[model samples]
Target: MRQMRMSHDEPLLAIDGLKTHFFTREGTVRAVDGVSLTVPRGKTVCVVGESGCGKSVTARSVLGLVDEPGRIIDGRIAWQPGAGEPVDLTTLDPKGERMRRIRGGEISMVFQEPMASLSPMYTIGDQLIETIRLHLPLGKEEARDRAVEQLRRVGIPRPEERLDAYSFQLSGGMCQRVMIAIALAADPALLIADEPTTALDVTTQARIIDLLRDLQAETGMSVLFITHDLGVVAEIADEVVVMYLGTVVERGGVDEIFHDPKHPYTNALLGSIPRMGAGAGRRLATIRGNVPHPSDRPAGCPFHPRCDAAIGGVCDVSDPPHIVFGEARSVRCVLHDDGAAVGGDFRVDGERA
Candidate 1:
């Protein structure tokens, strides 16, 4: 195992060759296969891919929530708690004392389904206060005050009254805000937001995204945001990780990934995003094939069949290396062989490959 080197300016978290697999009756599902990424301090890294692309599993794995049939078979999740040394999270027992302290205290997560994540049986205030109390040494009244303060910070109207409300009583957007409050209660160093605005209305979604950005700026916390929408990625991401079936095919700064994507999958995803003022009566572009099933993943490059520039015999038989470029950009594709583009293509409105 390669231990992560610790430094004051190092990333808040570093994941290297991390593999989380699911052992089921059908077969083993390589949910997170050989994935590697870093979450720099006080920056937002967005993981973009379609549903079942291992984005959620990767986030859950970091929180040590991969349960039952699933396991972290290999790799390391090195996290820095406070200004302390880095510790490999993969080595920590999932339900042990150390992991427990890290989960809601050092690293908090706002799950996708707020209604499901928030306990319906408990009052919203009870849940938030419990989290605040667990991580912070405070009296009952103090913890309740902290919870109420967080509620207000997240833009909840009449936060004091809403604190006593149940998850089912509040609207979806309100529940989402409550979830954010619970996650922010401890003021964690890293916040893993897994599709935080999935089912929210357009207005609510914008508010939620803006709230996250503002909170990050205020708290100086790093965020690992997982979403499939490129628009959302463009809005909040400083760095972007593009995942295919279970692997990251590309990673770069937000501008590089959007403006000069090297991988075919990244290009296709950008092309699929609806653009404004492109004239009327034109059909929206779509990635033709669905993400392949984990159990039945194809050989060589996972996206070979769907790639527009896939070279037969080469792309289908040999897996591409993670070719690194200047400015920390990288792409896993045969088309960009020998640090050059074998096939130059352009699809996005103002971009060229």
Candidate 2:
């Protein structure tokens, strides 16, 4: 394993202009286009968007997990390991030994479906011990002990006996917990949780979120959480990245994104969330249309077809420029562009002028 020193000043992971595409027989599918974001040390950055918005693809891209037919066409994924120089993950071979070590040892991922992610043939302990042994230099018995300790840490009751059980024998919640334990067994520097809570019930989801937060507090690992649920973002996210049709539409601090969304897509998403006192029988606000098909993406701004605030002439004819607000906030929308010909005044502070 490679040794990496820690630095608090720089971001743990930085992805810039990442584009992952699939060269299918019919047409090219651009899954992640010009997507950029950073995962600051020990912070949770949640990537939010509707289904098929490339949230999962972007996460997979970070770990060099984009499968065959789908390869990164352009862009750079710079991973900074604090002490040494920054490594551009985009240039590394996906199946190479260096990338393989970084994928699970330095950066681990908790996938969406626990049951599907874990093998039904192997006992829970077998998988967990394998992961631990692969990353750490330990004897068989030692690895097993570490596996049991991890299960206990993840709040699994009777962890020793539970380890002997297969994934199919455990409840959904238990399977998810086991998956989490396995992901953390190697003590990765960054945890890419790809909608880990999406498959659980409301109560189970809450517990899982709480567990992640607690584990982060204990381990100080940065997390890249991918999900479509705004409520989940509100609970755990320090920062938020809103993606639309494979590109980032808006990104900023969680409080800013929720309270003062700059992009129409972001506003529409916020409005769609169920509220405490929204009144009975009231229709929840919904975005006009589904995400555009990857191969059939629109000419200009991808969100224009569904955006209520889209300027017909400009948004349809040309792509929106990325507008910057302070240091940590940005939006790609004609409505926020200063040069765009629109009726309402646009301010750099993300407000009406």
TM-scores, each model vs. reference: 0.95, 0.95
The list of candidate 1 runs beyond 4 A from truth reads 1-4, 339-353
Please give the range of 10 consecutive residues that has the lowest summed lDDT in model 1.
343-352
lDDT of 1 by residue, 1-353 (tens): 34666877788899989899999999999989999999999999999999988999999999899988999998989897556678999998888999999998989999989999988899999999999988899999999888889999999999899999999999999999999999988889999999999989999999999999999999999999999888999989999999988899999999999998888888889998888987799999988788998888898999988876777777788888778896558888766666544455544333345
Model 2 lDDT-worst window of ten:
1-10
Over 4 Å off in model 2, which ranges?
A: 1-8, 346-353
lDDT of each: 0.89, 0.90
Best by lDDT: 2
Candidate 2: C-alpha lDDT: 0.90
Q: What is the C-alpha RMSD of each candidate to the true structure, in Å?
A: 2.3, 2.9
lDDT by residue (1-353, candidate 2, tens digit) is: 22334355778998889999999999999999899999999999999999999999999998889998999989888788666667888888899998988888999999999999999999999999999988899999999999999999999999999989999999999999998999999899999999998888999999999999999999999999999999999999999999998999999999999888998888888888888898999998788879989999998899888876667788898989999997889999888666788878754332455
